[model samples]
Target: MSRAQNETYLLPFDNRIEINPALAGLNKNSSYQTGNQYHFVNSEQTYNLFYASWDSYSNKLKGGVALNFSQGMLSGQNISTSAIGFYYSGFPIKINNSRILLSAGTEVLAATKHWAVAFLNNVIPHDNDAPIEQGESFFRYYIFKPKFGFLWTNNSLQIGITSTVLHTRDVAFSLIEPTTTLGYTLYVSKKVDKRVRDLYSRPFEMSPELVVFYREEATIARLRLLAEYTDKTWGAFVQNDFTNHISTLGGTIGYRHNFMRFNLNAGMGIPGISDYNSFMCELSLNIIVPPFSHSKYNPWAPAKN
Candidate 1:
């Protein structure tokens, strides 16, 4: 099965910047994040992907900037893909009580296809009538991708839309193959039991989010329900592919201490009439420098007294 270079199903929260450049400095403080995903497609096929990023809000620039790196490899394929991205977003425009921002970014990517020495030695005939001509055993190519997006935010609601061109060549010819995503976040609150409140320093909060990704080949959608208490978080999500009619189910647990937050996520393909076993797992970490010390620093501002 073919996978998108930026697919991060099980850990979307940790990889938001990869999905939308407008979110590069969306947080209130500078932050760092890194993660990896392991996809076990079947008994014989597997894929691994890794990424790291750092982003900071710049008061002087009145916006934010970010740097990110990611790589992916397949178990049986001799090909690997890697990319480095630089992103920026300008200051928000206030509308009533809400705010909105626009962002733009680009990435340089290198995709490599190579033949292993052992494979070349075993497969290439040396003495036969059909001796192959020896040439370079590897091919490497580079591509430039450009993207732009916007985000709108309020105390309880967030919506972002982003569009990216996969190839500079296509853009030059006006034949762009664009990938786009629409993401939403909603925060909810409920009265807490006094006993429950006493056990934790902060009140519990819940948010349900929905995100849709559109590509030339398919459209995928995910819905997630998340809860947080103090610095702990738990979440569950269901993802669906509209074109392929495939579904996945997953959950995540995370904790934050000091400047670091760690998370683990696991998911599996949902079987229909026929039983199937496809699994994906991911581990992620985030560090927010100069962690929020006051309520105003929260990503979602609280209502004033």
Candidate 2:
């Protein structure tokens, strides 16, 4: 039997990384930050992401850009699919206080598939409320959505709120409603102990996050609780997601040696439902670059008189 004859179907790609300027920093003293992540699901779908940002203290500014590429395939078919998107975050504004900063960003996405054209043309309505474009082979769209949020931190407590997909343009289907396009997230973190700040000089912490998603026909909400402990050399974390009374549990262990950090994560769905009840594993590696010597002419560097 061919590999395609013995394949399994899985859920569509829904996970996304929402860039936050506050979490991208190495420290208050560091000026540059960059990282990359790769994700695999059900041994079939794969995603890659890259992001980098520069910060300036004198001007109280932060700016960055990110890219996402994903590919997946259906079982028992010659069909293949992929999507590419780019994200850009502009300079952040300081909120008059040293503990708060507001930032904004936008993203554009394009995808290719054999059935996208047919689905948009036949399945989706072309009414006044649902505006779509005519195209062949590949479907291209722009999401002029702007994301803005404020990050506040003082000592061991941190809080953030980000609004994403506030608006949409050239939407091609009614199934994609404007109200459902809007996304909101709230996150809070607290350090549990001052002495246990070990993994990489960061203390043990607990965070709870809530995300509200407006769908074309319904509003969906999800909650996640995460606890982590880290030192300079090793770290570990446990996370749980609650939705519709079902909970998924996962954990990660990581180690930092010299300039490289390695992480491994495994997760399982609770109340295993059919094909969805299975274990998922992901591996990640990050390269840490040392801080550069302060330069008077570099805008990213803090000013020194």
Write down the lDDT of every candidate, Cα atoms only: 0.66, 0.43
Clashing pairs in 2: 180-214, 197-203, 198-230, 198-231, 198-232, 199-230, 199-231, 199-232, 200-231, 200-232
Over 69-123, each residue of candidate 2 has an lDDT whose tens digit, in order, gives 4344332222333434344334445444436655655544333333644565566
Give a tens-digit lDDT track for model 1, residues 1-305. 22333332223547777766676677557888899988776665566779998888886777889898988764544446688999998767999997888888888866554345335645767664332232233433456667787888776777888776654222212333543333332222223333454573446667777777776545677787777667898989886756445577889899978788898888888887213467777899998785344564674775453
Give the RMSD in angstroms, all C-alphas superposed, for model 2. Answer: 9.7
Best TM-score goes to which candidate?
Answer: 1
Q: Model 2 Cα displacement at 283 (Å)?
A: 2.6
Least well predicted 10-residue stretch by lDDT in candidate 2: 1-10
> After superposing candidate 2, which stretches have Cα over 4 Å from the reference?
1-19, 22-98, 114-136, 166-180, 196-246, 272-275, 288-305
Model 1 TM-score, all chains together: 0.74
Top model by lDDT, which number?
Answer: 1
